[model samples]
Target chain A: MKIAIKLAYRNLLGAGLRTWLNVVVLSFTFVVIIWMKGIMVGWDYQAKTDTSNWQIGGGQYWHQQYDPFDPFTFSESHAQIPETFNENIANGDLEPSLIVAGNIYPQGRMQSIAIIGINPKQNVLLLPTQKLDTFINAIPAIIGLSTAKNLKLKKGDFTTIRWRDSKGMFDASEICIVDLFSCNVPAVEAGKIYIPLAVLQKMTGMENEATILTFRKNKMDQQKVDDWVLKTNEDLTKSIDEMIKTKTFGQSVFYGILLLLSMLAIYDTQVLSIFRRQKEIGTYIALGYTRTQVIGLFTVEGAMYSILAALVSAVYGIPFLMWQAKVGWTLPVDASEFGMAMAQTLYPVYSALLVISTVLFVVLITTVVSYWPSRKIGKMNPTEALRGKIQ
Target chain B: MENHSIIQIQNLTKIFPMGKSDFTALNNVTLAFQQGEFAGLIGPSGSGKTTLLNIIGSLDTPTKGTVEILGHSIGNLSAKQAANLRKEKLGFIFQSYNLLAVHTVYENVEFPLLLLKLNATLRKKMILEALEWVGLTDKVDSKPPQLSGGECQRVAIARAMVKKPVMVLADEPTANLDAANSHHILQTMLKLNQELKTTFLFATHDEKVINYLKRRIYLIDGKIDKDILVDH
Candidate 1:
């Protein structure tokens, strides 16, 4: 095998431009695939991080009737705060929020929204809830950039919000938008408004009651609380995982096409090598190689392209990928429009396993493709090959 | 000197398929070669001398009878055994100066020694010595395409002689060379055979090569028409 490798290396180098061209094409495939995969992984990592900071804190305990997808459940998904969490809540290690489905009228246009009440002093979530602490003639509130855009309301703008209280009686109040924050998480940004927890609880006639509890990351010793469902960070991020999985599967088709083109080039080169270098193959046999060894030599010769490509990729790919990871790949279009928790700029993440496995896969496939055409050598007559006869 | 015989052939025949009938490439031939004997199969183009050489070199098997090369029967040897025999004890030179075109002249000469798994220092020494024998020591780094016909043939000679095999087989080796290159290469082979006591066998119709042969076995239509021994 050592001798074979030596001879194959010499042969490939001797072949000159033809060999390098193949290496360049294969190397391009490696870089592109690895880079694309890295972007996807980086997006997954970024999306989950943003979601954790902007919305789900470390984890959440949802009231038994709290179905985020069903707005009707918000009316009943509340009860008096669990006394067990009072101390942590007071220490601000955990924050309790109440959700009430309501309608907002801005310039005579009514839009349904989720009116969420959060502690203005909570430090776990990356929200501008502190702005709710401002004293104003009207109720102080904050909205996401998307919601502010939809309502055509900016900071300091006043809008009337109407909702039903605990007894199903309708009530209305005016709120002054204290802030409009931007975030990557769509669930936290779209059609959502935040007001001081005490204010919303009082207005809804549900004081001292909460619909969900969000704890600081790694700060709480969690227990099974009655009438609530425990959701860990991993559980909260499952939707992102599922979405990324679908994207990966879809991208695999493009990956397959790219890989196929590169493999076909190698396969064609191997077959052509056999055709054009028949005399060399026969000379090898004449020099004392068995047909099997000649086949092995050809296969090794083809597989070396992948190794060369990897080295070549490392040459230019490392610097390019590093720069990309630092600056990130900014999507030309708005990613939030995709209706997912995706950032506008996504950093590519490359792991050792991703690079190693990709290289191995190409090498393995190239070896098989190279060996496929070389099998014809085993049935050849060496004497004819020596004469450069096509057999 | 009664040197041990390196090759023994008995009533050997080779048949090839052509259309619906079989073509007799070698018909009922018999011959033997001794170590240190510089001999040639002297014949016309279709007299089956090259076919007989191929059988003796273990590149081909006989259809009938047997050819024993260095104590191994050519008709019974497996592909691997034949290859091993060729690698360890046999050398072949083709008509077109079959030097690996992409390889440097030194690499071409070093090829057989590599197959023998010789150490690098030893392989380099033998390759240099062989190239020296062919007066190609200065052309080590030149590829075949860069070398003239005469130089390429010399590189081929260096390759065939590098391992100092028990027998060196030449199949019309001078067919592609001019008269000048032909004699130059033949003289190199004769000197190696005499100095190393290695057997030399040539299948040729070239008078230049035949003039250098100590024994000439003339072939006519795959049979030995005349076998003559000449005193030097």
Candidate 2:
């Protein structure tokens, strides 16, 4: 095996431009594949981190009647705050939030929205909840950037909000948007507004009641309470995992096409080598190499292209990838428009597993493709091959 | 088989499938070669000289005969065993100088010893000595394409002689060289044969090669017409 490697290296190096051309192509494939995969991995990391900071603080407890996908359940998903979690809430480790279905009229254009009531001093979420503490003539509210954009509402703008109390009585009130905060999580920012918990309780006639309780820590070891369901961090991030999985599947098609192009070059080179180097193959047999050993030499020769490509890629790719990881690859368009957890600039993260697996995958594929064409030597008559006759 | 013969052939026949009919290359030819004997099979094209050489080199199998080289029957040897026999005790030189084009003269010559799995130091020493024998030590770093036809053939000779095999087979070795280069190549082989006592066999109609043989076997229509021993 060592001798085969040595010979393969010498042969490839001595082939001059033909060998380097294939190596360059394969090296390009290596860099691009790793960069693209790094982006996906980076996106996954970014999405999870943003979601944890901006919306789901570690974990949450939802009322059993609450179905976030079903707005009609918002009317009944509220209950009085349980006494067990009040101590944690006082310590700022737990935050209670109330939800109610409402409609806002901005400049006479009505937009249906979810009115969420959070503690004015809550620190579990990165939302500007302190903005809800303003004392003004009208009810103070903090809206997300997307909500403000859709409704054409800005800070210091007064809008009419209409909703029903727990008794099904409809009421209307003027609300002032004191702040508009930007966030990567669309679910937290789109068509949602925040108000003080006490103000919302007083307006809805549902005092000390909340539709969900969010905690600062990730653990869910608390005993089950009636009418509340625990959602762990893993469960909360499941949707993001599914989204990334779908994106990765789509990206794999691109990865496969790239790999196929590189492999096609190698396959072409192997086939051409077998055809052009018939005398060399025959000479190997004449020099006492069995046909199987000749095939092995050719396979090793082909597989060495990947190793060379990796080294070449490292020459340029490492710097490029490192720059990308630090400065990040910015998408041409706004990423938040995709309507999921995504930042404007995604910093790529490359793991050791990614690099090693990529190299191994290319090497394994190159060896197989090389061995495929070299098998023809076994059927060749060495005497005819010595004459450089095509078989 | 003769006890003193390094190569023994008995009623050797080789046939190829030409379309739907059999084409005979060698027909019922019997011959024996003693150790250190420099012999040549003189023939025209299609006279089965190369066919016989191929069989002796274990590159081809016989149809209806046995050929024993170094006590191993060529027809019955498996692929690996034949390769091992060649690796251990045989060398081949071709008319077209089938040196690996991408390798330097040194690398091409070192190839056979590499198969024998010799250590690097010994391989280097043997390679340098073989190149010196072929007068190619000065061109060791030059690839086959960079060398002249004569230089290429000399490199092939060095490669064949690198392992110091028991027998060396040359099939039309001087067919591509000029009279000057041909005589130079034949003289080198003659000196190596006399000094090393390696059995040398040639399959050629080249008069330059024929003139250097100690024994000449003439072949016509796949049969030995004359086997004459010449006192040189």
TM-score for each prediction? 0.97, 0.99
Per residue, candidate 2 scores C-alpha lDDT tens digits across A76-195 of 999999999978898898999999999999999888889999999999999999988888999999988877888998999998999999998999899999998999899998888899
Clashing residue pairs in candidate 2 are: none
- lDDT tens digits by residue: candidate 1, A81-167: 999999999889999999999999998789999999999999899998889899899999999988798789999899899999999
* lDDT agreement with native, every candidate: 0.91, 0.92
Against the true structure, candidate 2 reaches a TM-score of 0.99
How big is the positional error of residue B170 in model 1, measured in Å on the Cα after superposition?
Answer: 1.0
Q: Which stretches of candidate 1 lie above 4 Å from their native place?
A: B1-3
- Per-residue alpha-carbon lDDT of candidate 1 for residues B1-232, written as tens digits (9 for 90 to 100): 2246778888898998999998898888877788889999999988888888888888888999888888999989999999999998888888888888788999999899989999999999999999989998889999999999889888888888899888899888888889888888888888898899988899999989989999999998888999999888
How many clashes does the backbone of model 1 have?
A: 0
Candidate No. with top TM-score: 2
Interface RMSD for candidate number 2? 0.7
List DockQ, one per candidate, in order. Answer: 0.80, 0.87
